[model samples]
Target: MPDYSFLNLSPAEFEVLTRDLLQKELGLHLESFTSGRDGGIDLRHSRSRKREVIVQCKRYTGFASLKANLEQEVEKVKKLKPERYIICTSVGLTPGQKNQLLTLFNPFILAPGDIFGRDDLNNLLSKFPEVERSHFKLWLSSTEILQRILHSKIYNQSAFEEEKIKETVRLFVSNDSFGDGLKLIERHRYLLISGSPGIGKTTLARVISYHYLANGYEDFIFLSGSIDEAYSLYNADRKQLFLFDDFLGKTFLHLKLGRNEDERIIRFIERIAKSDNKLLILTTREYILAQARLSYEVFEKPAIRLANCILDLEGYTKQVRSKILYNHIFFSNLDQAYIENLLEKSSYQRIIAHKNYSPRIIETVLENISTIRPEEFVSKFIGYLDYQDSIWKHVYESQITPFSQLILANLLTAGTPIAMNDLELLIRAFAERFASKYGIVYSQIAFNKAITELENTFIRSSRDSKDKLVIDYANPSIQDFLVTYLNDLQDMMGDVIDTACFFNQLVSFFAYEGPGTPSQRPRRTHLAVTPYLATKLVNRLTQNFVELPSSTLKKRLNSNTEPYYYQVRRSVYNKLNFLRHSNLYTNNIAMRNFTLEFFKLIMIPNHVQSEDIGHYVSLVIYFHNEIPFEEEKILAALAPNIETLSDYHDFKQLEALYTETYAKFISKSAAYKEAVRQMVDWEAENVDTLDIRDFVDDIHAIVDHTKIDLANVIIDLEEKFQERDRDYDPDEIYDHDEDVRSEYRAEEENISDMFDSLK
Candidate 1:
């Protein structure tokens, strides 16, 4: 039996739970009354034309409080003179206390069973488990479940706090998505939840994860980094559930996915699909997913298409929207005056029925209610709903201080999940450069004060897998707000660029116009750079590239660690790609000279790895007409690394260059053909260890390029599939179709009555 503390629910939720349980226990469809001034009636069912059975529900934690509240209700009950009166209280009542209550109501009480207390409610829940499950908040908030959820190893991600999880469960109103998500995950062993911003994609993912956790899953793994992290942490014997929130980069695709990341993610999904003990849940903005599919051909696979669960506002029915609003208001810390104002005139209907109704907007407004003047609360609240885009704008402009705002600006410019130390360095750098313009004094004390104010509001500080303190926006909306804010204030772009601690920040702010770039805006918000701003940005990049910091150079030379190496490599790649794709490099002669000089300085043959070789080849190919580099040196770099070119993507790039560009000078060489044959042979030998999904395309490419026969490898893959099919069991799978349909029907029937009780 689940030990549920009804105290976790608001009085309104408690009332609804009581009504549902009693309706099940007594076989009567009771009509519920509005919460305030009930006139001695909470719920009533007509037994005949002349009389009705009446129920009075009091949600109190103590017997004394329950008795005192019921004493005031006695006279109202007497005047109505119902056929039978039943009293229900959350406070546990002893036999003596029940008798004492029976004396006060006399004939109205009729029997001790008529006075239902806390224990009786629990007993009813045990008997009617369906009712217990229907009230998600009631069971999810149980102390045992919350303890289990919080104690899971996955909570180290810092996004999942104890109070936050509890509050999320309390306020979450189930909709069709919950059931749909369950069926999808159960059937596919993976789910990709996509939706518009603020439509509760992450919330739905967390809810589904919690459901599996409460069932029998051993761990809830949060994939905070690349899909490789999932592969690293996967335990074949353990029933581990994994979540990758905003799997496609949150702000932009370039920042999120690296070379072949799309392929890597698809392969990881296939791996999860084959595993019986694993479940993967991913969430991304709908536009981001669309952009990914357009940018990366690998994402267009049928598996990815089947795994998508798109959450739309249409899925939120009027009743579902009402319950969402009612839950937020009921659990909110708003003063009674504000609550009354919302309840007055059924004003909540306007909000629910508004064109721009969003759960995020509602949560943001309610969260900052203390900042709004009581007199203007109603108008301002409705105003925010009217202008949904301005919800964060209002908060950013009015609620936060200018110092905190600067902190957010620099944090945004610096990019997300930046080290706390690095952000402090950038903040101090910004203050040193432009403190007087913003009318603020710069000090360690001031910086600390600003960060303290913004924590969990504008920004959140969390330790990553490495246990390094890093900061990211509290939510994506903050990043969204900051991007729009910064772009509109182009005057600050120069200052932002000048004060940036690293060159990558400058690159993140602008998108270049070229083929293969997203037709839609990049997820990473980019500023609309004018010609003047573009020139200024180009100059900064040139200066940074030409005069590489001595300390950074020393680190690059001294450290061989993968992280440091990759950091430098990624920064260099972003700069080169920006120049190659953007007009900044094409139109500016001086910028081109500086870029070539920088390339000569860093693109050493011995230092270049196989993974990075393609970057150099693509860069050289793009600038083949303008810049001159030795063909012999390029071939020299390619020859020794031929055997290491194992990734199919590398071969695809070479093939493209060979088939359609000036780079055939390198790709049509003896060394290139030998490299292709070696890679195909290596794969054929190690086929059993490789994922078939990854190698299937590779095999096709091999057959096209080298006419390599892989009959034995294909036979091996077929046998593996046959073995998997033989082991499959329909009885082992849990079907949520019936449960979901029942839950929807129950919610649909009760939602109207539940909101009516709030009037």
Candidate 2:
């Protein structure tokens, strides 16, 4: 039996619940009307043209209030003179009160059961358990279930407030994804939810997690740092669930998994699959997951393919989308005027049909309605739908403090999940350099206060696997908003570079023109570096090369005690790479000459590593006809390290150099042939443990050049795969793609028909 308070529902929702309950109890379809002055007809049923049954629903918290409201409704009920009248109220009714109500609407209300009270509704729900479960808010908001949910350790791990969860449940509209996700998790004990940004992956994950928690699951763990945390907390004796949100990463730069992280995650999935008491849920952007499969071999396994549950726009049908919009509008703080504008002329239908519709953008636009006038809400809302990217612009510009903005900019410049200590150091450095420009006083107290202010909004803090605190964007869209915001402000870009404490920040945040530059660099994607800004960056680099503070360089170093050797090496490589391709560095005589002097001072002493020698070679080769470095000088500096290069990437670089004007010189060298042979031998020896997909291209290139035989390695790889296939069971394979497509089509058709009736 449910001791449902029914306080979680709005007046409209309570009416719908009552209609649903009575329709089941009476075994007849009840027609409901739009919310307004109902004239004593909340729901209606007709057996013939002359016979009509009318229901009036009142959601009241006190019996006195219900009785008083009923007195007013008696006259309205008499005007139509229905064949029967029914009353439903959330307020409990005593026998005396029911008898008095029966006397007031005498003939219409013929029996006590004709007037349903709070206890009567509960009893009906007990009779129809399915109806109770269907009304999720009714059962979930019950005091007993809420206590069980909130007091659980899992709720504490996520830091979700009780009221916040209630609000989330109120606005959430269940779709095919929820049912599909539960079935997937039940079968495999693990689920991977992937979709584009703002497509409700995180929300779906939370809803499913809460569902399991409401059931018998005793513990819920949020894996914020590493898969190892899941393993550390696994208990085979008790039911447990784990969630690793954004498991691959949120941004492209952070997509590369940590050392063997892919392998650890796969192993953990296998472990969870073997246990009946455990479940794991992971979410990532769909594109990020594709990139991960390309970068990490373990993600390409068949098990991971089976666990994927993709949430796409097709999964959100017209009716579900309408319900989502209605819930948000009903629960929002907007006044009736604004709501009316949104609902006028079926304006909401345009929003649902818009190409750029997303749940996050809708929420963001509604949450910031105070920024727009009531008359302008529909136009501005459609404008937000059209642009979509500017949804965060108003809140970011006007809502946050300037110090907090600087902290977010620094976080964006530094990349995310930065060590808390490292972020504080960068913040202190930024404040010391630029606080006066913004009219802010620099203090440790202010820095801490800024971080605190930004938490759970623009940024979030969590401990890594080592229990060290780190900070990252609360949502990936924040990173997107900041990138666009910063790209438009050249002066701010300069400020970030000028106050950068690490050399990597310059490399990470900006790029010089070159064939070697990454396609995803800021210049191509977000920031357009003006010549003035480029010149500023070059000047900063040169000054840092000459007079970089020891403490600053020490803070930048990561577990290396080479005292500034690596920093100097990185500076030389970046400068030479820039000079080779950048028009400003090559055509501007002063900048070119200044960079050449720094390069000579750094490179003439043989400071380059074997891995970085390719950059040096590219510089000299690209400028062999333009610059005047002796060929012998370049070869003498690089020849001693040719035998030490063991990886295929190193050999690939050397091969590129060999095919250039240096082909005859490098082809005739004995050390170059030995390096190629050693790389081939290493691959052959590790074929059993390596992914052939990773090295197949390298092997083909090596074989084309050296004519080395790798047939035995290929045979060994084929034999291993064949043996595994022989051991696999065909019956265990689940074709999720076909089944999901069929289910989606059916759900869309069903919902389309159902929504037509409401309209």
Candidate 3:
């Protein structure tokens, strides 16, 4: 007999199968099966109005072992007084088991072939392809469908439950939004549902897809984070519904997309709007979608604007949350004590009002209800909800292997998918370089095994359109948790220096050697590290370095950051904020002393953004008030390019530095004496008597001082302006004096002539 064990049908699922088989295959009018009152009769069938048959279904896999259940079912069937009856089971019965059952019923009621078993069910399924396709859909699905469903189910088990999906959807207690969403998609041809993490956007999309699938739309496809694949799945000729979950991106913090990906997505949606037979539905985190609106501006396009319908799932009512919690509790297998405890008015209200209450959180909490003590259940549930980071940390610490943890660290650090080949290279490279520090070694095969272990939990591997196995965190929060955990690990580990070295290597790898660029060899794959992740790793290094003693921080700070210039700048900016408020940091002689050198290292621009250049300069000047820099220190900080500097606040601070530096310089030393002498010479050669003030103003303009700096520079400059004639060449000075006298004598002669002529 064919093995139907792969079906793994539950009791309820088996009944659904039997009901469909009788009505679809047997061509009989049958009564529906009702739960809790089936009375051993799953169905009553009538054929040709003259013959009436009774049917019974037992989902038992071991018919021989369950003889008692069979006998009891037989007794219940006998009371129905049916002229004919058939016993259907998922497993075949032995001759002894069949003979015992045969003896229990009347000969007219039961015959030798009256019992149907696995072989019989297989044959029936073979005969009716439609029934197999619908009822045993998973077993009958094509490999592509099976793989897609299996892969998606690993990150989310909803796809598995989808096979035996109950009429009542769990976790999503309300259908009102789903109904409205469905109508919007149907009417507009496109819909984008946006919401927070774990707010049931995906669930509502699933329900909508399943509804269309039920309505005879055969080409249902799902895509996540890839518009090219979604475009490939689009079939305009057939009636279909396409679902693109998190289409804008996942991980709001690191939403790095392929170039022009947003444009392609907008174009795809525009195409869908024109197609009458095809429908599109998309979902994304609300903040991410909002960012997309700002970044892509696709929603502003007239065609897309008209076709788009956004449903935001925020501010869920308390009643809705309560209902959601109850739904999860109802479906999950919690102990009676736990269930009763959760049902208590106070316990129910506590979860409903908890700040962290969400559909996904509720599912996670209730699924582990069996492990929690009944007495501690309520408090623990609230605790887990309140601190989801703790839960993620525990999951990471408990479920992951050492090598797998390293891989996850890399993935989180990389901030995007690492292809299998590229991931192998990264693992091998890190092991060879830092094996002594992290205390582990991994061969390629061992690395493969480790990743296999993490397949569905911390990391997920999926084939992109190129058919490369790209690995990423199962979700964005997983990445966030791992990054945070690794930063904490930097402090907790005993080998602090080695760990710092390890993080530096990680920083370097992402900064330069990371993926996303094509290799020199044809067909060779490389994963490019995202800029966000590279910046994050550098930031991590800065964070680690700041906690170390002054000696260590200075030692690391002295190293050349030329290769990772931009990232180092951002990291330093972040550190400046961290150290800005702490008196401990502010007072530390080492940090205070190293402040100028640290600022100089990060301020050195290597193709950094213009705005960032301003930011770096600002960090130094803002902290200058506390760090106490001299004239040279001000010049050193301002020595880098300032034309690109645009931040007004930092600009104001930069002005303050110049003004304060000039004031101190004039009082303490003749720093500006030479420049002042040159300014005086220029004014004498270029100016007439009337233009002397203009020449003095020109000297002020040439100095390039701010309003604040001008006041102090001008005070010393005015005296120098009066004495400019002495500093000029002696002939130039004497000639200018003689010309002044000649002009005065000429004006006197004119006045005398006028007076004599008037007399």
Better of 1 and 3 by TM-score: 1
Q: After superposing candidate 1, which stretches have Cα over 4 Å from the reference? A: 1-3, 27-40, 68-72, 159-161, 251-256, 389-391, 398-401, 511-524, 546-568, 571-574, 582-606, 625-632, 642-652, 655-742, 745-759
lDDT of 2 by residue, 85-158 (tens): 89998888899989999999988997988999889999999999877877666776667777777766662154
lDDT to native, each model: 0.70, 0.67, 0.54
- Candidate 2 Cα misplacement greater than 4 A, ranges: 10-16, 27-40, 60-76, 94-100, 151-158, 293-303, 306-308, 461-470, 509-759
Please provide, for model 3 over 53-88, each residue's C-alpha lDDT reduced to its tens digit, 9 standing for 90 to 100. Answer: 887777665766556677666667656667788777
**What lDDT does candidate 3 reach at residue 65?**
50
User: Where does candidate 3 clash, by residue pair?
Assistant: 515-527, 515-528, 516-527, 516-528
Any idea what lDDT model 1 has?
Answer: 0.70
Q: Of models 1 and 3, which has the larger lDDT? A: 1
Model 1 quality (TM-score): 0.84
Best by lDDT: 1
> Which residue pairs clash within candidate 2?
none
Backbone clashes in each candidate structure, one number apiece?
Answer: 4, 0, 4
What is candidate 1's lDDT per residue for 572-683, written digit by digit as tens? 6436755665444545555667777677665544545566566767776665666565655555555546544343354345444345432554445666556656765676
